[model samples]
Target chain A: MRVTFPHMGTMSFAMQAILENLRLEVVPPPPITNRTLMLGAKYSPECVCLPFKVNIGNFIEAIELGADTVVMGGGIGPCRFGYYAELQQEILHDLGMRVNMIVLEPPQGANGGLWSSISKLSVGQSLWHVAAASYFAWHLCKGLDGVLQSLDLMRARETVPGSCDRIWNAAQKSIGQARTYRALRMAEKEIRQELSTLSLHLHKRPLRIGLVGEIYMLLEPKVNLHLAERLGYLGVEVHRSMSVSDWVARHLVPNPRARMHTRKVHEAARPYLRGFVGGHGLETIGESVLFAEGGIDGIIQVLPLTCMPEIVAQSLLPSISQRYGVPIITLVLDEHAGEAGLQTRLEAFVDMVGARKVHRGGGVSCAK
Target chain B: MPSKIFLGLDVGSVSTKVVAIDALGHVLARSYLPTQGQPIVAIQSALREIARALPPGVPVAGVATTGSGRVMASALVGADVVKNEITAHATATLRVLPSVRTIIEIGGQDSKIILLNHGVVTDFAMNTVCAAGTGSFLDRQAHRLGVPITELGELALKAASPTRIAGRCAVFAESDMIHKQQTGHSLSDIVAGLCEALVRNYLSNVAKGKTIAGPVSFQGGVAANVGILKAFESALALPIIVPEHYDVMGALGVAYLAQPTAGQTRFRGFGVVAADCQVKGEDCDGCGNRCEVVGFRIDGRVQAYWGDRCGKYSHVNYLSVGT
Candidate 1:
């Protein structure tokens, strides 16, 4: 059975297998774009951010393409993503789209319930088999991500631009053809060996940029202009504060009793807490402040236009900046964005961060 | 050391408020006034009022600004700490109630319900896209119904068999209220129905899945409507406690955040009150986004700017300005 999925950040393969293992057809959603934005705008409230519009468009498109099932992940927190499934469901229903949805709660919340998920998965297969399949899928995806990242580093160093793309395309083709993890592992080695043979220059000039803003934008490279890639291409190692794993960690293990700092973060954010505090923008502020105190080189606050929560954080950031003496660039994105404009600002921000490093005598605090 | 005075200003779309506190965080004086379109003029007016009420020769220490128009005014006044309404609101709630579990703030154009678990905001939601469940909606409807906004609470109290109105949006709700009136529904009942619909819309829209526990307080301009208060109580199956400064809670929250003392003064000098302030937005042709870059200038000098796709504006230019 043919299957499709939305181009989720770092979750393309795992979702494929999860659905396939469940004996369901996988239909991939279309990539985010202006057309998608228009569709969401046409259907959604004009007040929602661009990402919400994009996702709704993705779901709508996928559903129209005969994709009957959808999977989304988020926790009940400051980010609007937590309410996305609910709202998207409503939108889809209003649009007369019939589809099944899987809303995965962060596994690391106060009540970590992995067993229940396993039970749900085991409905279509044996518990051992389902668990094995999930593990295999998870590892395969991680393995692909690790290899892709390394290849990317090599590709960026190549004197020739498209030459690296050639190798990457070849490697991706090989990995996609692999049916088993063993096969995938073998393909990874071959791809790495070939990538190493290409004239490659690798240096350790990592830009410890503290990314603060919307969760989806941070993770979904397509939406954030593939910022991590762009930074890496500029010979900078990117350190993103968000990941699906971290999302689960924060959601299930929210304010763990064992960690004093976790408790502190919860308390520090309590006063500003509201249902759907509407954005994870403050996560960026908290991280930026943390990064600053820890001596990170620079902070990037990325968010969508008209985003209320990030706007709140933006208003609060100056104090955090003043407190830590860290230089931060807060970027507000919207549909009218152009690559040339983005690249210029990114180049300027990077140059500024680099110059500031020299000014600070290269003292970047790399503490978590 | 010279005595220090701290100031906090909250410039909302509806009103401008300022509070002066001595070094020990004791409020020395406070003033509030309608913003009336020109925030710069309103702020100066507020400052003049505060200055008139304040004792003479009180050296200023530090100043803070909060609210939607805060970024503009904070830069104008060189505020030391420019914060959001949420943080400011939390600060005020904690200072007063200390153990407030929830805060129901219904402002002029928007409404929010913040839920706290042990002084931490665990869950919160805001309604900004529509004015259906906000104080402004009530005001407009009151004007349309030929009832004074101030007497809305009493009018609602008299609404027997409250008329049912679908308050999902202000326009629809108003039309529905009119339709119900045409059907010969009692005005008091209709008013009460409107109140219920507003409360219900707020709950479903903003407070969904949020367990607003007891010790909850209602602040902001709309809290002044007793009909809405009773509606909230009836809807939540619990009573809502209205704060003393209900009408000026946003400003009050900033006061709590300012927490000024005798020596910390970040005021750009009251001299700025008279500075020619021009705030406007321009559509950036830099990208397809065409972001409306809001530029805040004083005396032709760009003090702060924001609303750009990249950090093209907020950065570089805001060296002296807070975010």
Candidate 2:
């Protein structure tokens, strides 16, 4: 069966690896563009978050490209994401597009969990083969995240303009083409070495800003308008509060170390938010506080408009910003968001934080 | 010998403001002209007026552009510095009042509130996805009421008791104003109500959750309306300081910024006032992105390209004139 899935940053590499290893033909959805957003918005219910619209857009594009089966992750929360798959399926059906949907939901009590879901997809493959494929995919996911994390740091200090971006594009291409675990590891090492050794403005101490928000908005460059890259270009060191590997480690895998980190994050958030408001709401607050205490100059919260959890997080962020004396800016993005407006806001925000840093007697010059 | 002067242009949605400042930040010449949906024409005319006002052969030391059309203006004029209006506004306000803590800027299409601590911007918020609380809405309301926009403030100040109007949405606000008028409310009261409604909208939306501390300074095109200024004062319960060059503050601010860039400026002479410049937008169907690439042409030769998500079109040598 030909399978397709929605794009979420570099998670596609892992998804591609898993499907290709399982002897499945994978039709990767086209890179998100204006047309994708338009298609998604046209099909999606008005007022749903931007991610949903983008997902619908992906499905339509993939379907047109001969993708008959769709694989999507499922969630259980106060956030609208939990019901997206079901709603999307109905919408596609209504549009007279005949496609089979396989939802990989979080393993609950009785329904034979993720193993059975994987088994369903790997019909003729041996259990051992499936396990090996999963292991390779997981490693690739971790490798990609590592490369990206280092790239974020390198982007701010790269002496040559657009050099970091060029390296990153090359890295993504190499990693995507790497079939074996050894090749993947080699690709990761090469990219990391290139990033670390790249010519940089060593003396330029850039403003450190932490990005905390809804997972989709934080991960999707198209949705957030390449916020991290923009900030990096503005000479701000971007620290992403969440990553795909982090999500997989916490949710998909039963990693005790990941659980320990999650527990610490929850404890940090306990003083401000007691329980989960769903969809990374508590995580957003926790990360901001942590970032502030970690001596970050600023915090930027990016979320799609009409996002409930982020809206709640946004309301509480001002208090955190005030308490920690870190400047915070919440960017609410939607289809209507203009690039010019975003650029203006980002520039102003950088200026504000830079000035604040100088005011605090920090010896860093505010880069214009 | 004529002194070197710095020129700053603010190409806003409604108006284009040009200011020529000497080395000491003294305004040598200033001109304000309606953008009238043609920023290029407005910029040229404003420059022409400023050229007329300045002494003959006074060389421009540097040039800077700000406001919504900043990029376009900079491309057209070969600006030394292109900055956002927020920074420009803050710089100017701080120059006027060093101890200023709050700035309420309501422009043609957008409104912003900037909160400062010790001359550094502590926090700021701009109106998002809505123009309901901006000067354009007020201008439209004034037009519907058969009053010149400049006269709106004077008429509003004459109201005995302002009528209540909805400030949530521009459409609703207009319908509510019409309803209040049909119900026999006086024109002055309705006008006064609009000023109050817009102020309320601005506070609840753009300035939401932002602490508006004093000493407050109000500036922008709308700041010229004394009625709106009074409404802002009453709503915030603080006396607002309106600087002498309030309308041209953004241009003035950039002009001050341009002072440092003197002698190394890319100030393509005052000849740009008569240069034939045109902008054209074409949709690139090369990929799914279909970026609407905008090309800036001077004398029918494409000088620059922008608005593409990918740098491909922007980087292409569109410079060859006859190609």
Candidate 3:
């Protein structure tokens, strides 16, 4: 059976590896573009968040590319994401696209759990085989996330403007083509060495900006309008509060380190928000406080329009900013968001953060 | 003639402002003209007027561009610095009133609140995805009421008891105004009601969660409306300081920003007033992005390209023309 899934940043690489290792034919959806957004919006309900629309578009494209089975993740929360897969399946059936959808819901009571869903795709593969593939895929994802985190820091200080971006694109391409676990390790090593070789301005202390918001918006560059890259080019070091590896460790894997990190985040958010407001709303507040206390120059919350959890988080950001003396900006994006307007806001925000840092006697060497 | 002068251009949606300032920030010449949906022509005409006001051979030491059309204006005029309107407006306001703490700027299509502390912007907010609380709504209401747009403020000031109108959205505001008009409210009261409603919308929306301290300054096109100014004064309980060049503050501020780029200026001079420029848009089907790349041409040679997500088109170093 040909299997397909939506793209979420570099998560596709790890997913593709898992499917290929399981001996399933993988039809990866094309890289997200404007066409993807337009196609998704055309089919999606008017007021759904941007990620849902984009996912619809991915499914359509994949179905057209001869993918007969679609894999989607399920959630149980106040967020609309829990109902997306079921609604999307209905829409696809109405469109006369005959496709089997396997939603891997969270391993809860009476649910067949993740392994049961995987077994359906695996067909005759043994449980041992499935676990081994997952193990390799998990490690690959962890390594890739580490590379990306370092790249974020290096982008701001690169001696050459576009060198880091070039290295990143090349790394993604190689990672996609790597077949074996050893091959993946080789690619990661080469990329790490290549990144270290790129000359960077050592003395330049770039402004630090933490990005916190919805998971989809944080992970998807197209949805966020390449925000991290843009900020890096503006000579600001970007730190993402969420990543795929982090998500896996917190939710899927049973890791003490990840649990400790989650507890710390919850504790940080306690004074501002006590309960989970669904999605990443609570985490966004928690990360902002952590970043502020860490002495970051600024914080930016990126959320899609009509996002409920983020709306709740957005209301409390002003108080946090006031208390911590950290400037914060919230960008609400939708299909109608213009590139020029986003650029203007980012430029003005960077300038404000730099000026505030300078005024506060923080010697930040701003490079234009 | 001043030995070194700087030029600033603010090409907004509704108006285009140009200002030339001397080394000491004194205005050498200034002009404001309607953009009227044609920014290039408006820019050329504004520059021609400024050229006429200045000495024939006076050289512009530096040039900067601001406002919504900053990137396009920068390319068209060879701006030494391309800055956003927020910074530009703040820069100009601080230059005039060093101790100013808050700035309320309501322009044709956008409004912003900037809070400053000791000559640096501490925080700021702009209206997002909505134009309900801006000057365009007032202009539209005036047009519908059959009064000249310029006379709206004076007409509003004539009201003894202003009526109430909704200001949550432009459509709602229009319908509410129509309902009040049909219910036999005086024209002046309705107009005055609009002024107050807009101020209320601005304060609750754009300036939400912002602290407006004393020594507040009001600038931008809407600041000219005396009725709105009064509403602001009463709402905040503080006198609003309107700079002498309030309407062109963005242009004035950018001119100040261009001061440091003295010796090496990219100003194309007054000659750009006559330069033949054209912009052509074409869709690139290289990938699914289908970016609508726009090429800026001067004298039949492509000088720059923009609008592509990937740098394939924009990064091309085409030979410069008319520099």
Candidate 4:
């Protein structure tokens, strides 16, 4: 059976690896562009978040590519994202695109869980084979995240402005072509080594900014206007509060380290936000507090326009800013979020952070 | 004649502003012109006006561009820095009143509020996908009322008791204004009501959740409206400081920013007033995406291409390396 799924930053790479390993033909969606957004927006519920529209667009493209079945992740949260699978199924049916939708839900009573969804893709394959493939997918995610971390660091310090970006583009292509876990590892290693060789402006002390927001807005660079790279180019080091690896570890794999990390974050968020208000809303507050405690220069929370969960988080941000003594900028993006407008806000925020740092004798406490 | 001067261009959707400043931040010359749906022509005209008024021997040390069409203007003028309208407005306000803590800027097509702490922008909120509380709305209403936009403020001030008008969306506001008129509310009262409605919209939408304090400065094209100014004063009960060149503050701010940046002047000279700039868009069918790429031409030579999703054709100056 030909399988397909929506793209979320680099998560598609890992997903592709898993499906390919299952001996299932995977039809990846076309690269996201304005056309994709337009198509998605035209037919989508007018008030649904940007990610939902983009996902529909991806599915439409994938289905056109002969994908008979779609793989989607299920959620358990106050956020509307948890209900997206059911809604998308209905919408697809309404659009006359009848295809099997395999939703991987949280393990619970009478629910076969994520593995059951994978088992369908495995078909005649043994459980051991599926387990091996899952192992490879996990490693691939970890490796890709590690490479990304290094790329973020290098982007800030690169002597040549576009060198890291050029290398990164090549590396992404190479990694995408890697068919095996060993090949993925090799590609990752080669990219990391290549990144290390690029000259860095060692004397430069970059501002550290934490990015916290809705997962899709943070993960999809197109959605956020490549905010991380834009910040990197402006000589700021960006640390995302959410990543695919974090999601994998916390939800899919659920290792002890990931569980502890989640607990710690939950503790950090307890004072400002007690529980998940849905779709990383609590985590956004938690990460802001944590980043402020870690002496991050500033925090930026990006959310799609009309995002309900983020609206809740956005309201609480002012108090969080006052309590933590950290400057935070909330950017709400829609189709009309002009590039000039976004850039201006970022530049002004950076200027304020820098001026504040200088005013505070260039000490880390300025961010506090 | 000054040894060094900086040029700042604020290219907005409805208008273009040009400002020339000396090293000490003294405005040497300034020009405001309607963009009229042709940014290139408007920019050239504004620059030509400023150039004509400038002293012959003065040299522009650097150039900066701002506003909605900043990138296009920057490419046209070879700008040293391209800034957003928020920064430009804040910078200009701070230059005039260092103690100013808040800025209420209603421009031609957009409205924004910038909150400042110790002369640094702490927070800001801007109107999104709405033009209910901006200059363009007022301009359109003025046209519909058969009155010149320049007389709108004075007309609003003459009102004894302003009528109530909904200030939610442009469509709603227009319909509400017509209803007020049909109900026999005086023209001045309706105009004043419109101003009050715009201010209300600004407060509820653009400046929502913002802790507005004293020493507030109102600037932008709409700041020239005494009606809007009075509405702001009554709404907040705070003394508002309007700079001398309130309408051209964005241009002034960008000029100030460009002054300190170390660079050779990229101001392609005032001769560009006559240079023909054209943009041509064509669909690139290299892939399934079929990106509509636009090429910017200056003096009949293609200078840059943009709008391609992938940099395969456009070669985007900014990098999108990571997924």
TM-score of only chain B in every candidate structure: 0.90, 0.95, 0.97, 0.95
What pairs collide in candidate 2? none
Span of ten consecutive residues with least summed lDDT in model 1 chain A? A359-368
Number of the top lDDT candidate: 3
Candidate 2 local lDDT, B179-213, one digit each (tens): 99999999999999999999999998888888888
Q: State model 4's lDDT.
A: 0.83
Candidate 2 docks with a DockQ of 0.44
For model 1, the stretches where C-alpha displacement exceeds 4 angstroms are A1-368, B1-3, B24-26, B260-264, B283-291, B318-323
lDDT of 3 by residue, A61-107 (tens): 99999999999988877788888999999999989999999887876
lDDT of 2 by residue, A78-137 (tens): 998989999999999999999888888777433666677778789999999998887888
Better of 2 and 4 by DockQ: 2
RMSD per model, one decimal: 14.5, 3.0, 2.6, 3.6
TM-score of each: 0.54, 0.94, 0.94, 0.92
* Per-prediction share of native contacts kept: 0.00, 0.37, 0.41, 0.24
Candidate 3 residue A296 C-alpha distance from true site, Å:
0.5
Q: What lDDT does each candidate get?
A: 0.68, 0.87, 0.88, 0.83
DockQ of each: 0.02, 0.44, 0.45, 0.35
Model 2: residues with Cα > 4 Å off, grouped in runs? A108-113, A362-368, B280-294, B300-302, B308-323
